[model samples]
Target: MSDRAEAAVRVIEGSLRKRGRLRDSHITLAHGSGGKAMRDLIEDVFVGSFDNPALAALEDQAVVALSELASHGDRLAFTTDTFVVNPLFFPGGDIGTLAVAGTVNDLAVSGAKPLFLSCGIVMEEGLPVEALRRVVASMKRTAEQAGVYIVTGDTKVVERGAADKLFINTAGIGVVPEGISISARNARPGDAVIVSGYLGDHGTAILVARNELALETQIASDCQPLNGLVETMLRACPDLHCLRDATRGGVATVLNEFAQSSGVTIRVREAALPLRQEVKGACEILGLDPLYLANEGKLVAVVPAEAAQRVLAAMRAHPAGEHAAVIGEVTGEQAGVVVLQTVFGGERIIDMLVGEQLPRIC
Candidate 1:
C-alpha cells in the first residue's frame, strides 16, 4: 500500500486506543480486506454500535420466528429498501432511521402491519466506529416506534476508497390485514385525495443538510414511520380506494402513478395543498418545487367522498398526521396524467420526475 493507504490504516487502528469508545478518525482501505482489519472494524464499529440480541447472534443470517403463521394464516407482505444518502446524518434522521422508516412505510402503504425487519449494512473501513454506533442505535429506536423487531442482520466492510462511509439495506415482512385491500390501481374518479401531512419538508431538509448549507430558517426532515397513522385510517375508512407513500419521486410522481394505474386524472388544488412555511421558502430559494421533493413519512390516500371526513379525522388523531388535509380530487379526463389547479383557476400538468433532483437521497 502507498503511504496514504498506510496512513489511513493507522488512523483506523488508532481509534481503538480504549474499549467501548471509538476516538474520531477516518476510514482506510485495509479495514475491508477480510482479515484482522475487517474483524476489528466489525467488532469495534458495527457490533459495538448495534449491540442487540439479533445482531449479537453474529450469524450469517438472522433467524426469526413467525408466530403469525399460526394465527393470521399464510398471507404475508414483504418489502425491502436500500438507503445511500450522501450525508449519513441529516437534519431529522440518519440513514439508519430512513432504512427503518422506508421499510415500515412500504408495508403500511401496502395495507400490511409490519412485524419484523432484517438489516444489512455495508461500511467503509476508515469510518469512525462511533458514527456507526449512532446510526445503529437510531435504527433500533425507529423500529421500536413502529412496533417491529430487528430479528436478523448482516454487516460487511468494504475498502475505504471503494465505498461511501456507510450504506444500509433493510427488508421487512408484515401481515396483510383481512378486508383491507389497497393498490395504486384502485383509485377512481370522484374519490377525494387526502395527504397525511405536510409535503416537501423531508426532501428540502435533506437537500439543505447534504449541501452543508443552511437556510434562513432551520429546517428538519419529516422522516418517520406511518404504521400507526395508517392503521387508524384503515379502521375509519375501510373502503379506502388506494394508498401510496411519497418517497423519492415525490407527490407528483405518486399522483402520476395513481392516474395511470387507476385510469383516472388527479386534480390537486394548489391552495388546499399543505406546504410548511419554512419548506416553501427553502424550495423557493433553492429553485426546487416542493411537489417533486422526496418525503419519508407522509402518505396519500384516495377514498370515497363520503368517508373523507372520517378518514381525515382518524389521520389527524395520530401525531404523525397532525397536518393531514384533503388536497385534491380524482377526475375522469386525462387519464394517466396529474393536473394541478392553480389559485388563479388555471391548471398545469404534474408529470413524473424526469431525472433525479437529488441523487442518493434515500
Candidate 2:
C-alpha cells in the first residue's frame, strides 16, 4: 500500500480503542476465521449492534412470511448498493441511511413497493465500536420508517492495516404491482417532465460536511426513501410514463439516459427547476451546477400532458414531493438530446458528466 493508504489504515485502527472489558491487542486473523474469535466478534460487536428478531435467528437465510405480499403475484424488483462515503456521515444522514435510501429509491423509481433489505458490513480492525453500533441502529430505524425490514446480514472484520473504517453493502427486494410501468424507455414525445423537489441538497451538504467549508446557510442532505411517494403518484396518475431518482450524475444524466433509451428529446427550462437557496449558494461557491449534482430524496417523473396537474398535485401533497414542478417536456425532434433553455432564452445541450463532480458522495 502507498503511504496515504497506510496512514488511513492506521487512523482507522486508532479509532477502535477498547478499554476495560476488551482483551485484544490488535485484530488477528482468527477474528475472521469463523471460529471462537469470530463467534465472539459477532456476538459482542455485530449482533450486539444490529440485534433484532430476524438477525438474532442467525439462520443461513431468513424464513420470510410474506403471504400478504406474495399472494398478489406482483413482479419482484431487486437492487443492491455499496456505500463508502469518505466522511462516513453527512449533513442530512450517515452511510447507513444512504444505503437504505439508495436501495429503496432504486425499487421505487422502477414502480415497485419496497419490502426488505439485507446488509453486509466490512469493518476495519480498529473502527470505533460505538460508531459501528450507531450506524447499524440508524439503518434499522430508517428501514422501519421506509416500511421495509432488514431481514438478514453478514459481518466481517479485516486486519488493522487492511481497510477503511466501514463499508456497507445492502441488497433490497420489492414487488412491482400489476398495470404499473416505469422506466427510462417509457418516456415519449409530449410527456411533461417533473421533479419531486429541490435538487443538489445531498451533494452540497456532503461537500460542506467533508471539507468543513463554511457558508452562510446550512444544507442538509435530501436522503430519503421515495417508495411511499411513488405509490401515491401511481394512484393519482396510473399512466405515469417514467420515473427516476436523480442520483450520481443528477437530473442531467438521468434525462440524457431517458432521451437516448426512449428516443426522445427533453427540453428543460433553467428557471423552472427548483433548488434550495443554500444549495444554490454552495453550488455557486464550489463551481458546481445544481442540475448535475446528486440527490437522494428527489425524483424525476414524465407524464402525459393531461395527467401533469394530477401528478404534480399528488407529488406536492406528499412530504417528499412538496417542491415538485413541471420542469420540462419531451420533444419528438432532437432525439437523444437534452436541451436546457436558459433564462436569457438561449439553449444549451446538457450531457452526461464526463467524470463525477464529487466522488464517494453516496
Candidate 3:
C-alpha cells in the first residue's frame, strides 16, 4: 500500500474501534465463550486501558519488527511467572502488578533490557467484573511505568472451586546487549553481596493485609519494577557476576543459589543487613527470619570486590535502589554454603530454605 493509502486505512480502523461495554456486574462462563461477551471484557477492560497499537491489533499474537529488537541488543532474554497471591489486591500492588513486575524483574536480573510482555489470566466463574477491571487497570499502569508493552494475552474461566478468584501469568521478553554476560554461577571468590533495598516488605505487607498475623503497623509491598535500577548498575560495572531478585525464598535463598552455582562460600554480616523496623518487628514477633521473607522490588547482586563500592554507590543513587547495602562477601572456603557472622560475634550457617516461608507471596 502507498504511504497515504496506509495512513487512510489506519484512520478507518481507528474510527471503527468502539469502547467495549457489558451489562453484567459479574463475570460468567459466557464471558469466556469466545463470543461477544468475551470480546467486550477484553476490549472494555483490557484493550481500552492498555491502549497500544500491538495490543489493539487484537490478533492471536503480536509481531514486532526485527529492526526494533536489534536496536536494543544482541540476545533475547525470556522469562515467565505465575502469580496467585491471595486477596487479589494488596497494599502497594495487586495480582496484576505482581504479574508484570515479577516477570520483568526475572528478565532484568538476567542483565536484559525488558521490552515486551504477554499476560495470561485464569479467573473463577462469578467473579465481579469491577474486580477484573481494577486488576486489568493495574496491569496497564504497571506495564506503562516499566516502559514495556503488554502485546498479547489469553483469558480463561474455570469452575468456582477449581481455581482461586484469579490467577495471572506474565511472560516477558528483553534484549541482552553484547559483552554483558551475567549468571547465577558467575560469582567470584572475592565478590561482594548486596541488596537493592529494605527486605521483607512484600511478605509483611501481605501478612498485614491478610490480617492472618494480627499485626497493626503501616507497611506496603515494595512492588516496583527493577529494570531501570539494573540498567544503572550495568552501566557502572558491566562485569557484575550474578543478579537475582529475592522473591519466593528471599535473600537467603538467592544467596544459596549463587553460592552453589559459583562453588563459593557467602559470608554475610548480620548487622549489615538493612531492615525496615516494621518488617523486623513483625518477623521477630512471629518467630520468622527476615532474611527468608519475600521481596518484590529488591535484588541481590554479586559484584567483584573492586567494583562493589562503585556499583553500590550507583545503586544507592537510583530510585529503585536508594536503600541498597552490602550485606556479605563471597569466599573460597566452604564451597556452596552461606555463613552468617552474627552481631554477637558468633557464626552460623544459613541453609537453603526447604519449605515455603510465605506461600503465594509472589
Clash number for each model: 4, 0, 0
lDDT string for model 3 (186-211, tens) is 98888999999999999999998889
> Which should have the higher lDDT, number 1 or number 2?
2
Per-model root-mean-square deviation over C-alphas: 6.2, 8.3, 5.1
Lowest-lDDT window of 10 residues in candidate 3?
13-22
Off by over 4 Å in 3: 1-17
What's each prediction's TM-score?
A: 0.87, 0.88, 0.94
Candidate 3 residue 245 C-alpha distance from true site, Å: 0.4
* Stretches of candidate 2 exceeding 4 Å from the true structure: 1-31, 40-53, 65-68, 212-216
Question: How big is the positional error of residue 16 in model 1, measured in Å on the Cα after superposition?
Answer: 17
lDDT of each: 0.83, 0.84, 0.91
Q: Give the 10-residue window scoring lowest on summed lDDT in candidate 1.
A: 15-24
lDDT of 3: 0.91
Give per-residue CA lDDT, model 1, range 1-362, as digits (tens): 99999999878765553244433465555555666555565666666555567665667676656774435435689889999987899889989899999999999998888888888788887788668778988987898899888777666778757788899999998888677788999988799999988898878877787664466557788899999999899899877888989999999889999999999999999899899998888877778888898999999999999999999999998999999999999989877989999989999999999977988889
